[model samples]
Target: MSLARRASAEFAGTALLVAAVVGSGIAAARLSPGDVGLQLLENAFATALALGALILMFGPVSGAHLNPVVSAADWWLGRRAGAGLTVRELAAYAAAQVAGAVTGTVLADLMYGLPAVSWSHTDRIGGNLWLAEVVATAGLVVLVFALARSNRATATPAAVGAYIGAAYWFTSSTSFANPAVTIGRAFTDTFAGIAPASVPGFVAAQLVGGVLAVAALAAWYPQAGRSADAVVVPHLTEETALR
Candidate 1:
């Protein structure tokens, strides 16, 4: 696919992913007032379902990354092998993903009759939360690349969705493993939103986790770079393959 088409797919995918997250949180809060556990369950289920569906919908076009860390990992792991995105493509994908995330948050808020930019005040800072972010993000990176390396790329949509859903319950930070999503969630003060002040710590933790995961993958699967083209899902065309 052309860079324009791939970047467009990333934008749309990330937008809908955030919408699922924030919108579901809003609906869950309204639907199950005062029951935090049930609300979280509702939000997790919706997000998982939406994530799987969105990956299936956009994977063939753009790999459905929907996250900056995923895109960066793809580029980093595949650079030597020339199998994944170039530096230029990574920058474009990250920009598009972040923009889409913000747009998605706005859309979700508007759908719920809320302000477009409420600015979340849910302070989610702490050593435990930061540890959770690291664990969540590292696990995500490992799962994504490991599947690609093991020739299970076709199962990514379902597996990734399941892992994230599970992580929501296990992780203290509710697994906002994606930096773009973290930034987007700052735009809303709803259930899924993280305070803008908390974004930096979460993002830093996520990046650290990603780097650690990549190092582990490099050690375990020295040849993993060969499969980086299929991270998330194979979206490369014959034309791009030749490039």
Candidate 2:
């Protein structure tokens, strides 16, 4: 697909993803009432399932990265090999992701009869949460790039979704591992929202984690590295060929 087409896919995929997250969060909060744990369960389960479905829907067109870190990692790995995303493509992907996230949040809030563009006041900043962001993002990058390196791209949708679901419980930050997603979450004041002030720390931690994951992949799974096309599942990838 052309860059424009791929970017559109990225935008659409991310919009729906944030909708799943924020919408489910609002619904869970309403239905579960004071039970935070149950709300989380409902939100995580819905997000995971929707995420898997989105990846399967868009993986062929854009790799369904829907996350800047994944795009950056893929570009970095494939830069020298000539199959990675161009600098222009990377910028487009990032911009689209952030915009899509905000749109999704707005749509979700509208669905719940809230203002379309309300800013969240939910405080999610702290040392432990920062650490959790690092851990969560690091694991996510490793899992994604590692799969790409090993040519196991097709398995990524289910595996990545499952990991995110588990990370919601295991990590202190509820695993806002994607910068775009983090930004989107800051737009709503609800069960799944995060304060704008906390976004910088979370984004920084995620970027650091992504860098570490890239370095780790270079060292430990060097053989898994491939051309830019190998970064994720594309339309004519090995996974599709196998099927």
- Say which candidate scores most in TM-score: 1
Q: What is the lDDT of candidate 1?
A: 0.93
- For all the candidates, what are their Cα RMSDs to the real structure? 1.2, 2.9
- Structural similarity to truth (TM-score) of each candidate: 0.97, 0.94
Model 1 RMSD in Å is 1.2
lDDT of 1 by residue, 112-155 (tens): 99999999989999999999999999999999999999999999
lDDT of 1 at 18: 99
lDDT of 2 by residue, 91-154 (tens): 9999999999999999999998999977889988899999999899989989977777777878
The runs of at least 3 residues in candidate 1 whose Cα sits more than 4 Å from the true structure, single-residue gaps closed, are 241-243
- Model 2 bad stretches (over 4 Å): 236-243
Candidate 1's TM-score reads 0.97
Q: After superposition, how far is residue 217 of candidate 1 from its true place, in Å?
A: 0.3
lDDT of residue 140 for candidate 1: 95
- In angstroms, give how far residue 232 of model 1 lies from its true place: 0.7
